[model samples]
Target: MSDTATVYRQRASARPRIEAEPPIRHVAVVGGGTAGWMTALLLAHSGYGPRLQVTVLESPQVGIIGVGEGSTSWLRGFFEELGIEESEWMPACHATYKSGIRFDGWSTRPGHESYFHAFASMLDNLTMTQFVDHVHRRLDGEDVHAHPDRYFLATRLAHACKAPRPRHEFPFDVWYGYHFDSVLLGAFLQRKAVERGIRHLPRHVVAVDRNERGDIASLQLEGGETLAADFFVDCTGFAGLLIDKTLQTPYVSYADALFNDAAVAMPTPLDGPIMSQTISTALRHGWAWTIPLTRRHGNGYVYSTAFCTPEQAETELRTQLGLLDADVPAKHLRMRTGRVEQHWHRNCLAVGLAQGFIEPLEATALMLVQRTASLFVDALEKGDLGAAAQATFNTAVNAQFDGTRDYIVAHYKTNTRTDTDYWRANAANTRLSEPLTRLLKTWLARRPIVGGIQQGTFGQGYPVMSWYSLLAGMGLFPDDGELRAPAAHEPPHSLAAIDNLIQRSALNFPDHRELLGAIPPRPREESLQVYFW
Candidate 1:
């Protein structure tokens, strides 16, 4: 791992620049939809639209390839940070608070399945000392599920349909996220960007022009008109018109790390607006996801081409869910699991599907668009807009992709189901990331540092409370060896402390049903509703 301090020094020395000077004056964003609009939004929101001309070249033909919305904690926070109002979002996107994902039937022998919810919150939490004591007590023949049941609050609240309250109202209650329609979220972002004075031209990119230095200098539209810019952002989706096609940057395939390449999405209706939560279940050929949006449920099967064909996969989906709407079409999208070696090459940076993508297990794909744009703006702030800064930016973007790739891979790798071809394929896959391999070894030794793909992804912005949920609730506990709290820690808090908070806080909140009743009829997910106890 590179030292943070050293990386900073090397970065500054690599790109010497004028202080507070904007290296990129006129920026051209290629493509549209969520990624393009997101990039434009951030640029405009950061006060770049006024000083640097920001033009989003969108093609009505190149529609966004997104199913419903399943996003991370960052997604909501990003909107909140941007000061976008709740009503501006909720009504348009079938937006609702998402505590976490519920995975059903990934374990057990053929056909039989059980499930657990991977919440942003946790069950009861005991300090290290208390946890060790509980473990010891368990070893001595006592059941500790009761203690952990109290410790992890999310488990009970999910069943009860209660949202976590502010810290003063509960014990260890903090951090939350959302589940909104992807298409609507994209529209919301586009509207905000335009409101901030961003220029959006609905034009399809026909060709990419490069200067002698191999940097993208202009974009040729379908009408034989050329648009020029000092810096270009390739939000062009998979075509990569500006980033790869013009710059000739090579892409590294992550198919080996992330096996599932294709997904079939179907929109199924429920009786009322859907509740907030995405259910990702492990299927035989691949994993299937059921997301309950406000008006309809978004269902998808993501599987590897090696295991099944599109036609076969579609058949399986239909058999599982019965026929989707006869009038509306069910779409099947194909993709490779990986990204460009350089997300930012030369003056061109590729965002969204163009940069790369893994399967959308946790909705990291959407956040990637926002994160990439925000990070580049950070780089720009560092006055490292020269060639060196660009290279470093590319390297850092790849790191983020690789990190996310491994994180998603962990979900499949840490599982122990091997009943069907799909499970077998995911299980037999021996390749794992270096960090994951180390974590797995630690977990095997019962030292439990952080194991599998999805372990410990939340950083300072995200705390231990979040990671601990997926760790314990999903049955991916670290081994007994690592269960001991770090040397100087105190005993964990009592489960009673956690549960009592929920019990008390539940009284103040409106019935989940009541809240839904007050809202307008949502656009989708008519059948499902979720409440926290």
Candidate 2:
């Protein structure tokens, strides 16, 4: 070989090589609310605090959508991962422990309508199918006056108006979430994120600038100031400031599958003692959720615009609530049920409402934000997210969204409430996704098998048991001996055993009000402004 070629090869071999791109250093999060602040804090906590500069651009003029006051039990793990102490923020946000949700008046059968989707996972070592079979036998007897929920500890506690005592650590048997003021929750998370050195920008973004490669370059502020970063997170809510308007990402709408499009949210004085769980009462056009916070009840009527006008919905809500007139103030919100075609595109990622939203039926908004943030952190830990990483992230995120949508759709589709066109249309055989349609068919022959719902591309959605709660609550159980043929040597749990478990839990758990009153009060300025959880 020539001397010049030999020298070049030696030098190339001598130099160190970089296996992957450098980790994201500067992240600019646009918008400020629960999603924005939550994203900022989570990113900051993911070993990016001092090195990775996280900036949140929040506008003082934009109002937050504070109706998502309820949450699922998944929030506990998120809070724990961030080392967020419950004592520090719970009271500040007017949060109360939520055991689960209770559904009332959704079924066609008289005198046996209400059922609970309790937080309790399972009883003894029995599988959900076995427990369900045990309950089915009792439900079939003409002389037996049994309710299946009585067997579960969480349900018993909720039915008795009791709440579990607060614990100081993680990994508990009885899972729980919370009902809190969403606006206040944003404020509380903002304080935590800012203290951790996340830059807070109280400026409105007037324009988005893109580089030659069509990636987000910077955000133009109202005063012509430019804020730039290496990565961008769009938490701008429904506006989709960076993801849609700038990148022109396609969106897949769920309008055909889901019907509710608007919500009339209001807060009212506590009519009675605070309960431990959210109450989802089935209404004519849709459902009404009553979330109990420490100070008041956050109530909303989530109804379809096709079935009723805003004025008509308000009137019906008032009638159901027994309100004489507009003594209580109410705000209306329009929602789009869909997701961006790609959650992570180019250099930008959309979180929360900016990504898309389903209704608050299962209180999944915050849960999705938490999941998406964590997933991004995991991806970043491996290497800088290139095309391949972005594809994986998008696939995971889309599966989660689709799974959650199917679960929510199940609530509407399984209902026997045919009192209105809204309910009738939902109950009618509409176009269900291939997976959900198959599962529904399998469930008709027998109880839902754990493997059927839990197996998928994303095995991280709802637990297999949750489907049982929802289906049972909607009165969709199979006939007496049709659930599953008993295993040859399988010993079954008796009703007496189940009743004993319920009695023990009821005796051990404290009343909901007792636990509420025990919490130390935090001092703050009182406000007359109505708030929703």
Candidate 3:
């Protein structure tokens, strides 16, 4: 046998085996939408015995907060774990592949007005070292090409309007996610969970009954039916029916750091070929997200009501979409931008908006939900839902939320726009977390960010490359006139070489529109009027 194969076998055999029975046999997930259905699906698929029953309590009267949503690469892993093929769910969800997000006009620096934050791929390993080197050199006032868009393959693919899927001959895998109808996705997951033997209870939670220990005990339905379970998962969006309303978990608001609390969303017709990336353009009061699905474009303006009225935000969005006089309806949403003190409090766990939300700039809503559900499953299996386990889970999950918040906060903090009061306020905001403050200081000092990022607890939310991309993309360095030629001993970077490599790598991926065309199309469903969750 090969030496590598022998080592792999030895390591695989050395791992400890788990044999304990699950502590909780019944898990009730309240509030059905993407969050509830997803949690239910994860629990149903968890290798727990058939004795463990998973139930989703969905209210029929509640409308879905359906928008064209984008996801991070985590969704790809979710589908892989469930053995659900892209061909199966993508068509059903009116989904299109997303390579990454393209930020437009977030910065006003010349040549840095826009940048693409591409999802990392296996191919990045070959070029990331040099990219980091160039970023450092540029920070040192050396003339160099360090734009993030130049080194990443996903950026090239997105620019070319190509899907992330490589040809059969290509050996490297490109990580990617999707843009889909949120409502359709929830429905799709509901179907999958039901098929996996998860029970679906469509009833409104009229009241939450708590045990003497302050943990959730049972839920009273509107129809006078009472449903009890060992553990409860709250996917009740902003209502926090189980976690907040019943358990009274202390909610921490991010309003001081993240100013955008209100959003106006509406759909627009697809005017041309589908693009493979979400576009986030800095608007007057806040930012606008343009997400392309198969049938239409999902456009929304997420702004602070403190700065502009909902009507003004909607008008701006309508003007941007050229629908100012058009009859299409717009959905206005109010967001409570913060997380609860404890995600897994006692017997109840909060997921989705019930847990908390950072803005959708990076399409992290579903990503956070998926992470929480996955972690809860692992904790349940290994720790048997013990107090120590719950504490540990809460600590880790809270850190994750904070870490994601720091990254999103950095976007506003580093923005160079001065066009509006919103931009000026974000620029001058001092309500940053200590971790973010330190990271910014380190970057401003032109020190190695990887070391600080490595030592920090909150930095794990985003990779080291992402920090580099954001800082470098925003042109957060010395003036161009101050740049000097590199020293003789300093190794040179070849922009042409990186460009050639990206162009060549992109050739393997098919056109985004053509790739969607190849997927078997499901019959289009009528648009459902819904509120933003």
Candidate 4:
């Protein structure tokens, strides 16, 4: 080891084999909505499965801000990992079947008390000790919804309208999710990423260039077409064209812990069929949401332009949704939650609403845009990305958008409704983040259940039957009665496998228009749909 350390280890072993990342053959995906063709159809079904060449610029006068519609149950494994076929995209997106979301009158303000949080994953090990002993005998006074009561199967399939059936092993039978029509799920994933070939440019990026070691080397459309790429995803929504406008990078603003910041949206049409679930309610300054979508029934409200006054929150959201056009024309928006501290800055990567946002209630804006394009194709198929695997994939997609913005700010700091002035001003303009104020004091003292998958968002939050159905449907049930004894710590004898998984989920639940008459529809712009398989 002499002579300049043997020529610096022979010029670092003849340096020259980065190929600058592989498989992502010429991808672009600036913004097509639904997180730009769901990250260009999962990077064209992984590593450009069909001769890699995705495109999707989009912006024919920019639009797609179709707020969330609702989803979970890992969007049925992201439509079978993109081969797609939930009967060809849930009836062209009129979709319906979400067995969750009721949240009515969010505690205190006219609260008639509620709790079910179902999407089936009814904790195993003697069905979460007999569904916490039927929610501690419905808080010691029985009536878990009366009559030989059983609690949680999303509370007996919400009075038996049922819906999720086909199962072989999804944590174990019928745990569903889907509401659909957020602009027909971005036009049914932009027509199945153009019949699985993908390529569209519509235009309107205006400028993106970058390269002095800054990375994102192309895209400047607006008629002067110039789209180049090795990689770049920035679903351009909150105008962050390539991780905050050509990499100026720097976002992180849960406005001191979420302040509602205004919203409006509309659609209204429901009369029948479309209502598998999704409601929200709770008003006086914020929180509305409805959502049915098989055609229409959206509604939104979201409040707080510093506490009401968007003409008094659209006149209290058209006097609690009677709506004669709930103050007519809609989709107002104002946002200011936060994220993008670095959803991969250099070679560009900022998915959906340009990486970070909270306040869709739940339905996690296309599940963090298919979990940031399936964790950036599992860190580019372990090929090697360095900068510590891009800071561990931008700290695991910024801890899944800051652990779902602290579970949507623990649904407004455990709101017991301070009656108005936006529930009498709380959530102190976003100051909670000390690990979500110590996981909301062990999630409001139930002690331990701080998101398992072993904490810190990567198994993407919500589970424990979606925080046992939104902190026991916002009544926040758990002052430590040790969940009032389900045979005080175990065995009630195989607890009849929760009554044989509720009589095999009642002869395998059906009727959501008979599972859309058993899957089939693959059309778009609406019409011809099915998928009960």
| Local distance difference test, each candidate | 0.63, 0.75, 0.85, 0.65
Candidate maximizing lDDT: 3
Alpha-carbon runs more than 4 Å astray in model 1: 1-19, 47-49, 109-143, 146-150, 162-174, 272-274, 324-328, 450-468, 474-497, 511-513, 516-533
Q: Please write out the lDDT profile of model 1 over residues 1-533, one tens digit for every residue.
A: 11110110011011223346576788898877888887887776553326767999889786778787687756654664455555567668876656566767665422224444434332222232344355334333343431233444444444455443323333343234566678787787778888888888888877777789877788888888999999989887888877676777898888876788899988888664344456787777788888766677788898888888998888888777877335557798988777988887888888998899887887788778878998887777665587788777777777777767765776677566767776666767778777656655554454533223224332212223333333343455433443434333443345666567656654543333345444432222111112111
Give candidate 4's whole-model lDDT: 0.65
lDDT of 4 by residue, 307-406 (tens): 6568777767777777745455766877767887888776778887787778687777777888878888767766666689889988878877887777
Q: How well is each residue in 10-122 modelled by candidate 2, as lDDT tens digits?
A: 01011122354448779999998999999998787764346768999998778898863988876765665565656777888988888888888877654349887776432
Q: Cα-based RMSD of the predictions, in order?
A: 7.7, 10.8, 6.3, 23.2
* lDDT by residue (tens digit), candidate 3, 1-533: 11111110001011133466778989999988999998888787766646679989999888888788999988877876666778899989999999999999999988899999988766776678778899999998998888898899999999888988877677666768899999999999999988889899989888888888877889999989999999999998998888888888999999899999988999988867789999999999999999999999999999999999999999999999899999999999888799999999889999999999998889999999999998998887674677789898999899999999999999999999988999999999999999999889888898878766755643558877788888899889888999998888876787888878888888888989998878532212311111100
What is the overall TM-score of model 2 with all chains considered together? Answer: 0.87
Ranking of predictions according to TM-score: 3, 2, 1, 4
- How far is 359's C-alpha from truth in model 3 (Å)? 1.4
Error of 1 at 121 (Å): 5.3
- Model 3 segments more than 4 A misplaced: 1-19, 519-533
lDDT of 2: 0.75
Q: In terms of TM-score, which candidate is strongest? A: 3
Candidate 3: the clashing residue pairs are none
In candidate 2, stretches whose alpha carbon ends up further than 4 angstroms from where it belongs are 1-22, 110-112, 121-130, 135-148, 166-172, 457-460, 478-492, 520-533
- Structural similarity to truth (TM-score) of each candidate: 0.81, 0.87, 0.93, 0.32
Better of 3 and 4 by lDDT: 3
